[model samples]
Structure formats: C-alpha cells, structure tokens
Target: MMNGIEAVIFDLDGSLVDSMWIWKDIDIDYLGRFGLEPPPDLSREIEGKSFSETAAYFKERFSLPDSVEQIKADWNRMAWDKYMNEVPLKDGVGEYLDWCLSKNIRLGIATSNSRELVNSIARVHGLEHVFQCIMTSCDVGRGKPAPDIYLAVAGQLGIPPRACLVFEDIIPGILAGKAAGMKVCAVEDAYSLEQAEEKKALADYYISHFSEVLQG
Candidate 1:
C-alpha cells in the first residue's frame, strides 16, 4: 500500500519457504547427538543472525568442540538435505512473484543465510531467475537488524531505500529493512506470526500470505 515503491526485497528462509520449522528439528537432532538439549532460547538467538554468527553463538552457548566452520558445515548438510528434498514454498509465493514481475517491479533477495543455501532453495522453487539480485549477509559485513544487508541490496538494484519495499518474516529482518529506511511488509509464517506481530511493529504492512500482495 506504500506509494512509489520501486523494488521488492525478500527474505529467503521462512519468508519465501517453509523451512524455519526444519531448523528446530536440526537444532534438536544436532544437540541431542552430544546428549544435550537445545537451550530454550536457541531459536530466538539464531533467528536473524548470519550463518557464521549463529555457529559462533552455538559454539559458545553449547561449549561445542567443533570449529565455527565445521559446525556451520554440519548444519548446512542437514539443512540443504531438507531444503532440496523436503521444503516447499510458502503458499502462493510463485504467483505473487509473477505478479510483481508483470508489474515490472525489480526484485531482490536479502537473507542472513549463506549464498549456497539461498541459491539451493531458490533453484528448487524455480526462483533463481526471478530475482534481479541475490544478496547474502556474508556478502555484507553485518547481518539482519544491522541495515547493511538491505542497504547493499538496494544499492545493487539501483533503487533508493525509500523506494524499496521489503518482505520479511522475522523481527531482525523487519528491523533491518526499517533501519535501511525502506517500507517493510511483514509476512507471516507458521513459525513466526505471533512473534512478528509482537516484536516487528516497525513494518509498514503485514500479510499472512503472499496472495495479499495481489490485492494492491
């Protein structure tokens, strides 16, 4: 509903695909391997962090023996398997992307996930070609809630931050978009709706489904 928005930037994991719940399973299984239970707040801590940041947090919090890269690789192996073989797009996202394309709105992806992970899921959903740019937090010096990632994406798209709209499902992503001075549309997912409502009030709009985008 924001006027004069020229581009749309999307968050990959829970926003575009139903993969957040998969992370919970990964956390439980991975921690259980060492006879440890996942800390209650583990999911919240990692929700908006970059892969490397998350690994570091896990290592420190769990006293894990693996190096950060090793831990990340292990997590990626399990995640990629789920993403490639099991994850599905959030309902109606493909149609919504097509609608945006038809409107000639530039599109980009800005995610805290690694580039490999984002590309894998985008490829599985046939969305690789739909985005003008695919930017990962690794490409920037900081991750979500920092504004750096979204600012980089806007720069890549040749759009002013005020002229861009961001679609985000998590608090950190929404805050990042807001910090970048863009209009944000908070998208709801099974795992994030309640948290989004309570913690992401900075978003300019809220939609439970991508289909809501077509209503404009």
Candidate 2:
C-alpha cells in the first residue's frame, strides 16, 4: 500500500485512535443536561460534520441555549478526561508509525475533531513530534466528504494529493480522501461496523487492523 505513497494522513478518531466509543456517551450526557435524548439517527446526521458544524447542529437541533462556541467547549470539557485516560492507539498503529518513520514517509493528521482534543491526544501519546503536520476541518472551509481538509494536509506536507494515503473509518472520510485524489484505506471501527461492506466498496483498501498494512 505504500508503493508510491509519500505521506500518510490519518483521521484522528476511529482511524488512528480508538476514540469513537467516547462520543455516544458524551452526547447522551450532554443532552441529558437539557432533559433531551439524541435521536437514533443523530450520529448518521453528523457523521462528517466539522467540530464547529456539529456544535451548530446541536444548538439548532436541540434548541440549545448555548452559543456554538459554548457547545463546542462543553463537548471538549466532557470528553477531555476520557481522551487522556481511555483512548488508545489502534492495533498495530505503534508499529506502523515506527515503520513509516523508518521509511522517511511524511506523516500528517487531517481530522474533524477539535484542535484542543487532537493536540491533547498528541501530547498525551508523546506524538507531538511524530506527525509533520496536523490539521482540523475547522481550519479548512469544509469537513469530510468535501475533500478540503485532506487536500489541505497534503499541501501542508508538501506532498501531492495522489502521493498521500489516507486512513479513515467512515464513509464520508473515505469519500473525502478519494475526492482529494488520494488512496484511501478503510479502517474497521465498532462505531462504524455496520457499514463495513459499503466502506470496503468505496475505499481502495480495507483493513481491520493497522498490522494488515505492515503484512502487505
């Protein structure tokens, strides 16, 4: 998979880190403050939205009293401790990162998550220097399924779009990478397990663990 790849860009949640499981509980607890429960399709609706966009969505959808920025802050506060203590690198990710470093492959992060949390993850994992570039959808004009963030990361890494390989765990993310003219590898995550077949169809490759890439 690294054949002609110059850079590897990873989506933060679910892709590089096993953090997708934290969100549903956060949503439940956050909305519980208002005595509201998330609709069953809430995750689907916000699948590819940027952090700012998701905050705005909650404000409008739930008739929230907080501003968009406040909503985002609340989420960051709610998820902070969990991210630091609970989230972990996906299987074989450590080895894969080492391999990439050994090959002198440029590494980057293109995520839809908040910068605060992403930075926190990097610092906690001692990955502050691991990636050459880290970008958020909030910094770009649009979020996943739009290709803006992915393209931006590739540009920042000074690598061509086609030379960057993206690891993603959701359909919108896979679509975004493809739209950016990069090869996308669909990652398996319990949060998106139901869409496994579709992800496989959309991505150039699919793997349940990062170890699969090393084996190939």
Top-scoring candidate (TM-score): 2
What are the lDDT scores of the predictions, listed in order?
Answer: 0.86, 0.96
Q: Candidate 1 residues 1-216, lDDT tens each?
A: 646988999898878887888889999999998899987777787778888888888899889999999998998888888889989888888998888788898999998887779988878878878999999988896778899999999999999999999988889888999999999988888887667656446788888878877776
Output the number of the lDDT-best candidate: 2
Residues 168-208 of candidate 2 have per-residue lDDT tens digits of: 99999999999999999999999999999999999999999
Predicted structure 1: lDDT: 0.86
Which residue pairs show backbone clashes in model 2? none
Residue 169, model 2: lDDT of 98
TM-score for all models, in order of appearance: 0.95, 0.99
